[model samples]
Target: MTLELRCGDVVTGCEGVVSGNTEEEVLTAAAAHAAEAHDLTTIDPATERALVAAIHPV
Candidate 1:
């Protein structure tokens, strides 16, 4: 999967095999990586929201 960063760079990946294809799982995992590895606490709220929404798809 391709995920666009706040800086407009697209990162194509996932660290490990996706156990379950769920939106919350994907977002939480990605967000955790952003915080832990990149030291990015605050990301674009709009983008984040969009990503989460896309994953969840009400």
Candidate 2:
């Protein structure tokens, strides 16, 4: 399964591949991606929480 990631109103997971066998790992990977590739230093806390919550279960 693929996890759809939305930044604000922009969807970023459509053309991308998500890694991890579980939701938690997937979101963790995504956070690493955001920090590494996107340089998102000010990413919203709520958004991060939601991402972790939504994607952390497989």
Candidate 3:
């Protein structure tokens, strides 16, 4: 099964949806997307937890 995450679920107003074969892959892509599109350079532990929690099987 593929893992999926909607950027909007974590970041307000974002319409991006990222999916991957594993959580690591989704996290990596989400990190890149956060930096490139949201100007978010770093993710704190709390936010990281949130990101992980937001991921779901699709």
Best by TM-score: 3
lDDT of 1 by residue, 28-57 (tens): 665766677667676588757755544422
Q: What is the lDDT of candidate 1?
A: 0.49
Give me the displacement of residue 14 in model 2, in angstroms: 8.4
Error (Å) of candidate 2 at residue 35 is 0.6
Model 1: lowest-lDDT 10 consecutive positions: 2-11
Backbone clashes in each candidate structure, one number apiece? 0, 3, 0
Q: Kindly indicate the candidate among 1 and 3 with the higher lDDT.
A: 3
Candidate order by TM-score, decreasing, is 3, 2, 1
Cα lDDT over the full model 3: 0.93
Over 4 Å off in model 2, which ranges?
Answer: 1-15, 42-46, 49-58
TM-score winner between candidates 2 and 3: 3
* Candidates arranged by lDDT, highest first: 3, 2, 1
Superposed by TM-score, candidate 2 places the C-alpha of residue 43 at a distance from the truth, in angstroms, of: 4.1
TM-score for each model: 0.44, 0.47, 0.93
Task: Please list all clashing residue pairs in model 3, or write none if there are none.
Answer: none
